[model samples]
Target: MTPASEPATATSLPIGSDADLAWVRHQVRQFAAEIGFGLVQQTKLVTAASELARNTLLHGGGGQAKIIPLISGPARGLRLSFIDTGPGISDVELAMSDGYSTEGGLGLGLSGAQRLVDELTIDTEPGRGTVVTVVAWATGVPAPRPGSR
Candidate 1:
């Protein structure tokens, strides 16, 4: 059993190339499983990681991903933070809207990722970089909204 209301193990991985994206997804799945997330939970977390990792690589000029296991009382979950140092998003509001893509694709990266996770946060600075954090809690764990963590 994991420690209650205590910090668990965390992982950090570089997010540079396409290959790195695969590794991120794999590690995220593993982390989710380590915390006893069900198949659905693992799948969703992996999917969300994949999208954000891609954005970090393609849009942010590569970055790093930090995977952390969480335990708050009986609540357990996984938190993934994707950091990049490329050109930051100038308009986060427009960027987060559905069907908005800067690369001329389907434009569902950010919004789609938000739907797949329990909590999502975006911290970006124009010309500096971007950091996106997401958490997927195991069933029955009440996920905190942005700024509450």
Candidate 2:
């Protein structure tokens, strides 16, 4: 695994509906592409974002996705954090399993998302909410644009 660093830039988008999910995916795709991720890698990150965004809206009752561009020495990556304040996961292990879901989903959102990104972290509490973070690394990152995202 590559070493990590602070985000060079960041952006936050709300996850309130299907339209919001599409918007998140588009932003992620654009950023991932700009940062030098290959087509396959970009797709993986966007797919994971879509699934987590859906979870935020449908299950968590709405939230936001904090998108961050990270740098590790000369390499770079993108981190996406989906946060919500609604009911949290009761069983994290179960939630990561192959065929488990709380919302009658085909049960592939979280599990499949994990397989897509370079790093994944899910923080939750029974009563609080959930924050699902995913990071995708780039093979060759060009110089990023200056200024805030």
Candidate 3:
């Protein structure tokens, strides 16, 4: 099915509070499970969402994220979109490279997100905004993989 055909659940929030981020993270975990993603994939997706939320707060001057659920028959998945109005990435190629971080800390956000999911897409321009989308799926289940207790 076309990516747009996937059923989606989206929430938009300002980036001024930690509480907002936490809530979004929780929702992401719940949504991932509903979409039938594996545990490893769910963890990775949640982490990626965390990174995007932080980026919106710190870098994008606050933005929004749209989480979409992709059900590909026997393989269920999720599509995450993080969009920000802040200055976009000047060098996406460099940013994706390992060990490259614009922030003072290790820059594992984008790169690590890319590694965790099955598909990754990015659109950004200097002065405009940034949009990062990631998709991941369950490997062997009609339903979501069991979560770790």
The TM-score obtained by model 1 is 0.89
Off by over 4 Å in 1: 1-6, 140-149
- For model 3, residues 45-119, the per-residue Cα lDDT tens digits are 888888877877777777777777665446677777878888998999998887887778688877887887767
Report per-prediction Cα RMSD to one decimal.
4.2, 4.7, 5.6
Determine which window of 10 residues in candidate 2 has minimal summed lDDT: 140-149
Candidate 2 regions off by >4 Å?
1-3, 140-149
Give the per-residue lDDT of model 2 (tens digit) for 1-149.
Answer: 43346786789999998899999999999999988899999989999999999999988999999999887556678889999998999999988998897778789999999999877899999889999998777866543333322
Q: Which candidate wins on TM-score?
A: 2
TM-score per prediction, in order, is: 0.89, 0.90, 0.82
Instruction: List ranges where model 3 is wrong by over 4 Å.
Output: 1-5, 142-149
Q: Which of 1 and 2 is the better model by TM-score?
A: 2
* Model 1 C-alpha lDDT per residue in residues 35-138, reported as the tens digit of each score: 78889989989999999999999999999999988876556888889999899999999999999998998999999999999778999999999999887788
Sorted by TM-score (best first), the order is 2, 1, 3
User: How many pairs collide in each candidate, listed in order?
Assistant: 0, 0, 1
